[model samples]
Target: MFKSILAAFDGSEGSEAALSKAAELAILCGAELTVLTMYRHHSVLEGSMYVTNADQPDDVDAIMSNHAKATAERGAALARQAGCEKIRAFVKGGPTARTIVGFAKEHDNDLIVMGSRGLGSIEGYLLGSVSHKVTSLAQCPVLLV
Candidate 1:
C-alpha cells in the first residue's frame, strides 16, 4: 500500500495510460497522487538557434516551461476524472529521469509510475530512455505502463 504515488506525465499516449493506472492505484491505496511534468532547460545558445521572428522573439525555455505546466494540469485533471481525490500537479525544468527520481525521493513517494516511453528527443535514442534511467536511478519501486 503506497502512502504517496508519483506519476510522470508528459501529455503523451503512453503517459496517459500510466496516469490512469497511477490514479487507479492511488484510489485503491488511499494515497496522494502527484503528477509531474518535466521540461529540459534550454541554454541561451540553443534558444538563439531556434527560428524566431523579429517582431515576436520567443523565449524557448519559457515556452517549454509553460507547456510543461499545462501538461501537468491536464494530467491532474485526468486523475481527478479517474476518481483520485488527493491529487497535485507540478512542472519542473531539468534532466527528466534524474529530476523524477529526485522529486519522488524528496516527497517520500512510495511508488513511482510512468510511461514506458514518452515524448523523447533524438538524445533519448542516442543515450537511453527516461524510463530506463529512472528505473535505474530511483530508490523506490517504479511501475512502467
Candidate 2:
C-alpha cells in the first residue's frame, strides 16, 4: 500500500504511459501523487556569453525555464483529470534519473511508477531506459507501468 507516490514525467510520449500507471496506482492505494520533471538549469549559450558580458540576461535559461514550467502545468492538469485529489508537481535540473531519485527521496515517496521503453530485449540492454536506471537506484519500491 502506497501513501505517497512519485511519477517522473517529461511531457513526452513515453511519460504519458507512466503518468497513467501512476494515477491508477495512486487511486488504488489512496495515495497522493507528485509529478516530477527535470530541466537543464543553465543555458549553454548564455553561459558562454558570460565570458564576454556577465551582466546580460540569460535568454536560454529563461526560455528553458518557461518550457519546464509549462510542462509541469500540463502534467498537473493530467494528474487532476485522473481523479487524484492530492496531486502536485516539482521541477529540478540535472540528470533525469538523479532528479527523479532525489525528488522521491526529498518527498518521502512510498512508491515510484515509471514507464518502460517497451523496446526489444536487445535494444533495452544496449540503450538502457530511464526507468531502468531509476528503479535500480531508487531506495523505495518501483513499479514499471
Candidate 3:
C-alpha cells in the first residue's frame, strides 16, 4: 500500500484523470494525498530570452501559478471527496520534472501520478512530454495518466 501519494496536475483532462486515480488509491490505502503544480519565473525580455517568455506587465506568472495552485487545491478536494483523510496542495517554482521529482523524493512519496502531456513547448518547459521525463528520472514509482 502506498503511504504517501503525489499527484501532478496542470488543469488538463489527463491530469484530472490522474488526480481522480490518486484520490481513489489514497482512499483505499488510507494514504496521504498531495497535489503538486510546478511553475516558472520568466526572465526579462532581453538577454538571450525569448520575448514571448519575458515577464509580462500583468503578472502572467502569478496568474499561471494561481491556476496551477487552484488545480492542486481541486485535486485535494477530490481526495477529500473520495474519503482521503490526509490531503495537501503544493505549488513550486522551477522546472516541472525536476520540481515534481524532487518533491516526491523529499516527501517520501510511494507513488507519483501525472498527466501524459501538457500545454506545448512555447508555453513552458514541462508543457509537453514532461511526464515521460519525470517517470524516467523520479526515484519512486510513477504512473503516467
Name the top TM-score candidate: 1
Q: Can you give the TM-score per candidate against the true fold?
A: 0.92, 0.79, 0.81
The models' CA-based lDDT, in order, is 0.93, 0.77, 0.79
Candidate 2: regions farther than 4 A off: 43-58, 118-128
Residue 50 lDDT in model 1? Answer: 91
How close to the true structure is residue 123 of candidate 1, measured as C-alpha lDDT? 66
2 against 3, candidate with superior TM-score: 3
lDDT of 1 by residue, 18-109 (tens): 99999999999999999999999999999988986565539988888888998999999999999999999999999899999999999999
Residue-level error in angstroms, candidate 1, position 139? 0.5
**Model 1, position 60: C-alpha lDDT score:** 88
Candidate rank order under TM-score: 1, 3, 2
Task: Report the error of model 1 at residue 1, Å.
Answer: 0.7
Per-residue alpha-carbon lDDT of model 3 for 1-145, expressed as tens digits? 8999999877677787888888888888889889887777655443234433345435556666777788778777776887778988999988888889999999999999887776536443443468877978998999876
lDDT of 2 by residue, 1-145 (tens): 8999998777866677888888888888899999887776665765665443355445656655667778877887898888877898887777777778888988899898776653223546533467788878999998776
Q: Find the candidate with the highest lDDT and give its number.
A: 1
